[model samples]
Target chain A: MAEKTLSEVNERIRDGSVRVVTAEEMPSIVDELGPAGAVREVDVVTTGTFGAMCSSGLFLNLGHSDPPIKIGRAWLNKVEAYGGVAAVDLFLGATQPSIDRGIEYGGAHVMEDLVSGKAIEVEAEGVGTDCYPQLGLETTLRLEDFNQATMVNPRNAYQRYNAATNSSQRTIHTYMGTLLPRMGNVHYSGAGVLNPISNDPSFQYIGMGVRIFLAGSQGYIIGSGTQHNPQAGFATLMVTGDLKQMDRRFLRAATFTRYGSSLYLGIGVPIPILNERLALSTAVRDRDIEVPVVDYGVPRRDRPSMAKVNYEQLKSGMVRIGRQEVATSSLSSLLMAREVAATLKGSIEKGEFVLTQPVAPLSLAGSARPMKQTKEFPYVEDVMSREVVSVTEDISVAEAAQAIIKSKFDHLPVVNSAGVLCGIITTWDISKAVADGTISQVSQIMTRNVFSTTPDQPIELAARTLDTHSISALPVVDQDGRVIGMLSSNHLSRLFAGRRPR
Target chain B: MKLLLRVAPGIVRKPLIASVILETGALVNIERASIDAVSGEIVLDVSQEKCRQVKDALERLGVDVILLEIPVIRDDSECVHCGACVAICPTGTFHFEDWRVVGEPGRCVQCGACVTACPHRALRLVLK
Candidate 1:
């Protein structure tokens, strides 16, 4: 059987004679007609994936203001956007957290809000210059107000990804979702056989300048993604497209609670059935793709791998690990993937969508390296909570209790008139005072022999002391023994939980 | 029908499940029980007709009864069948059958633990 040429496929698509099928549909078609016959009959195979792509962001020229400020610092709805581009140009990263609300609101939210026709507050600051004299400006702007807006993502469409599970005794929060303790849940991210790059494993027709269905609009592949590693079992691509043509339905802003904000990208790639090889690759199924089941409980990227399981076993919902059969779940949305493929198929059948040849093929070589550790040791002053809420020794028992409750602190540092660390009062002490009806001053019930830490001391020492003494918080004092800040177990846990060993 | 009962610390010594079975004459399958000297919780499957009688009897015994509904498996076509829900479920409501995830609705406690544990957001708890 002769393979179809790219031009022939395009002509067939234009004339509404080409048969279009999705990656999900190709398997049965191949089974029915065999490889050679299927390659001869099918003209295109559409693939897609809807997963969190953190390396995604939008570049927009906010037009020009009345005074025309060269935005050195910019923010959209309190989420900081990169202002280092041109005078009015800004790049809002998908994972950039909201300044006020942290991970809950971010650049992805801003993009979704803009696409939904919601007006967003655009605040920018810059040094006044001769050409652009405005120092600061605050105004609401919509997506329509932008001179040019495009989604320029450094990475999207991962070919495949590992399944994550926790082996440790404690639950871990990750971008992959929450992993319960002792192999509680395994979370995998990828549409497997339906993924675009997975369907085109060798990057045959997928290259720079290839037309793609991006967020419901016609888009193109830009280049290899930031960490493109074809040798590492999967391919990654960098893509770009006009943001104006995109819809709010295809763009969603998601907050992974403690893990932070991410953008759910809907990308569809159409492959021209150019050859028998290409047709066979597109017929790949979940049973054929394999990924490692990695333990996220280990704090490093080189975490222990319990087993390498295929998507069939993963989709089967259970895999054997040693003597136990562990459950699995996927983070990628197969529903969206199928929808994209179906939509692409409909467009091709209607002779509305056309395929594009690559301007340049992606590089097949290159590897990504892990981040190196720093040599510097951090100090207590660097990590301590500077916004100290201390109670004076003269405050009444009721007042002390109220302060502890309002601040949500189990222990409150007691200070004196001379700006010195006097003592520390705890909730237990306040409860004791309330029980005895000794509603006098905090100094009467406060613990005087308080162990304090110094600003210049290593943070590890303070943490060790807190753990060793079973204390909740420690007051950080300066050289003059003046209370400067407070360090708590909660603060330390948050810092160390996600941190790699230096 | 299955129900999860939270026995208060004061009624920890009482045979709440036994009393309910006797009062309702309902056949009970204690799928899982985590009772201690202080307090306890149990997941029990009983006859559908006698479920109400069993619930009332447990309530009279000072036990907080929660009717368990089978968690609807959302979008099974999209399910990869990884058993993350099995690891977190206190009751063996989710298990592997020929490497596929099979939901035992009769044994489900409706704890909602599996719903949150499902990475695909497939399982959802609904009232019976």
Candidate 2:
């Protein structure tokens, strides 16, 4: 048997004699024909993955407006895009939240909408300059209106990732998706054997300038992705392409409630059957790929690990964690992955697509490390919820209840005429009073033994206090015992969730 | 022949399937059924000779009958076994066994909820 080359594969592809199959089909084919036979018969195998890619965004060069302002701020459907570049050029980060709506809408949705040909409201403010007189502009723009619309993602195609599960009593939302509490379900990302990087684990052929199928268009690997960890059993790549050539069908936006917005990217990579080694690599099975199962309940980057499980075990629907069988799910769409691979295969078979040798191969060494702490402690004021809505003790029970209902707050710090902390009233206290039929006065039902947190104190101390008491919220106060802000579990959860890498 | 039927609220209260079987004398192999107070749908396999009679009987009973080709699984090899389909599936078509996600197309009602709920977009409903 002779070794194959990319040029020969391209020649075969052009002549309609190429034997192409998807990554999903390679395993069985290799099993029947053996590695050498399979390599001899097949010319290429296409691999793909469609999942939540947060390190994705668009760089748009908007044509300059008449009397243009040197735009310093820009927004798309209320989601802010960085306008620090030129007056007409801006970069939109996929996870950048909406200023007004927060996580509900963001840059990802704006890009998806643009790809779908929906007009988006573009707002900008600029400092007036002689070259550009206009200081502010608000207008709708579509993908066709841009001078250049390009997707220049810094990192994508994670080689392998940890499967997430929650051990705490409360459900936690992360980029992994909603993790059900107490290990109710495990959520894993990546299409395993169907993933492109998983097939090219060593970055042998996949590197800078390698042709790829990006968002329904032909794109290229631009460089090594951020935090590229080749030795960590997975490969990552930075890819870019002309966004104008792509369609909405291949690009989508999705929101995971509290987890924020992410781009659903359709990517496919075609591997040239260069050798027997490449053929065997492409035939890697799901059972052979292993990823760690991490406990999402832990609030640290180096969170506690439960166990390492292979994709076969993870896909089995249930894995034994200790003595219990825990259910698992995947975030990456296997259906879309298959479709992408099949679509690429069709293109290759028709001689419309050809394999490319990378101009520059990817670096094999480098590892990502967590940010080191510079300060000993973080202040409570930094994390505390400053917008405190309090109630006066003189108010009636009905008034307090109405305040709680209208504000949608679980607890209200009660203040006296002197603006001093008098007591605290919670929905639980109100409910108990109502249940006991003593709902006449607010002071009678409010708990007087209120514990307060100081803004100057360490956040860890405040968190510890909240955990020790098992309280939902703590009123942050000054030395005078006047309520200044509120600290709650929701705030802590957001802080920790934000810390997790996308 | 296999058929998928959508029974309206008006016909849901009646013994429709039993009546159809009695009238046509055709064996009804119900693949799946999701019946609520408002509406109901069922997938069943019957003899080709009795398919036309079953459709006529169902229409007479005010049930919308659709001659359904089996729902095609576009890609089974890529399934990650996340069980998102198991939550919303009215039919016991999707299940988790041995820690992996499995789909029994024989029991599928072509509801399309699993296709929507699957985060990975791994399941697609192609009704021929």
lDDT of 1 by residue, A1-502 (tens): 5577788988998898989999988988888888888888889999988777888999999888888789999999999999999899999999999899888788888988888889999889986789999999998888899988899999899888988888976676788777878887787888888889888878898899999999888999998888788888767889998888887656777666467888887899999888878888999999889999998876655889998988888777678877778877666666677777888889899999988889888888746777676867667777777777788898898998888887746888998887789899998998898898846889799999898888877778788678767998999888777888888887777677865222
Q: B1-128, model 1: which lDDT tens digit per residue? A: 87887888998998777777777888998876888999997878888888898888888888888877744445573344545466566667767664366787766656666666554456776642
DockQ of 1: 0.13
Taking all chains together, each candidate's TM-score versus the true structure is 0.71, 0.67
Docking model 2 quality class: incorrect
- Candidate 1: the clashing residue pairs are A315-B80, A317-B81, A317-B82, A327-B82, A327-B83, A327-B84, A328-B82, A328-B83
Write one digit per residue (lDDT tens) for candidate 2, span A1-502.
Answer: 6488888999998899999999988999888988898888888999988777899988988888888778899998999999999888999999999998887678888988887889989999987889988989999888999989899998888887888888977766677776767877777888888889888887778888999999888999998889888888756879998888886666777666566878888889999878878888899999999998899977656778898899888777678788778877777666677778888999999999899989988888866877778866567788777777899988888898888887635999999887788899999888887888856899899888887788887777678778867898889999898889888877778777764211
State which candidate has the highest TM-score.
1
Model 2, position A431, has a per-residue lDDT of: 84
lDDT of 1 at A225: 88
Model 1 RMSD, rounded to 1 decimal: 11.2
Model 2: CA > 4 A from native: A378-502, B1-128
Candidate 1 local Cα displacement, residue A322, angstroms: 2.3
Each candidate's fnat: 0.19, 0.07
Q: Tell me the DockQ of each model, to 2 decimals.
A: 0.13, 0.09
